[model samples]
Every structure is written in structure tokens, then in C-alpha cells.
Target: MPLTFRKSFQILPGVRLNINKRSWSITTGGKNGPRHTHSSTGRRTTSMDLPGPFGWRKTRKGGGH
Candidate 1:
């Protein structure tokens, strides 16, 4: 199995800093609101939670997904 590493730090009430082996990202937003993320590898993502198991996510990256 492939191994992965990740960690998150809460900077503020609605802000977070996430780090992985290859890159890092900052996310801002609340649970009931739309969340936005931008990574160090030129990836931008916006996601939102829905009523149940349904949710929405859109991601754009400079290199590949």
C-alpha cells in the first residue's frame, strides 16, 4: 500500500493550513458556507457540503489532478 502524510492546523475560526508531503494548502470558509482552497502547487479548489451525502467540488491545477 502507498503511504501518505497530511496534517492540518487551525489558524483562526474559519481558516486552516493543510500540509502534505508534496504541497500545502490554505482553506478558508465555514461548514455551512462555501469553502475555498489554494495550494502551493498552483491548485485552486472550491467545495461545498449539501444536505446529505451529496456535495460539490471543483478543482483547477496548473499541472495535473
Candidate 2:
């Protein structure tokens, strides 16, 4: 199996938000990743300390999946 590193952020316990950049930025692995708001501030990494609205679970549209 190929190993893939996914840049993700955690808003709160059991909740994480994946980075999805539309443009090329240094924070976004340059072109392939999504640009981060924390990266523009000359920060090597961004902090993912926040509260999540929903628990750790995949959100489904319309009805439950």
C-alpha cells in the first residue's frame, strides 16, 4: 500500500478538518495542497485547537449514511 500523508486540522476532540487549498502556496505543499491561513503569518505549522460543532463522524447530506 502506498503511504499518503494528509494535512489535517483538529477543531476539537475527535473532530478534524482536512486542508483543501485551491491555489499553490508554501503551506499547501506548494500547488498540490490547500493554502492555510496560519501559513501566511510565517508560521511553520498551524494550531488546531478549537471546538467542533459536531462530534467525530462523517456528515451526510439529506438522510443518514
Best by TM-score: 1
Query: lDDT of each structure?
Result: 0.94, 0.36
Please list all clashing residue pairs in model 1, or write none if there are none.
none
Quality of model 2 by C-alpha lDDT: 0.36
**lDDT tens string, model 1, 1-65?**
99999999999999999999999999999899899999999999999999989999999988466
Model 1 stretches astray by more than 4 angstroms? 63-65
- Counting only residues 3 or more apart in sequence or on different chains, how many pairs clash (N, Cα, C under 3 Å) in candidate 2? 2
lDDT of 1 at 27: 99
Residue-level lDDT of model 2, residues 1-65, one tens digit each, is 95655466656544445543432113222222332333322334422322554222222333322
After superposing candidate 2 on the true structure, give the runs of residues whose Cα lies further than 4 Å from its correct spot. Answer: 1-6, 22-65
Worst 10 residues of 2 by lDDT: 23-32
Residue 42's lDDT in candidate 2: 33
What TM-score, computed on C-alpha atoms, does each candidate reach?
0.90, 0.23
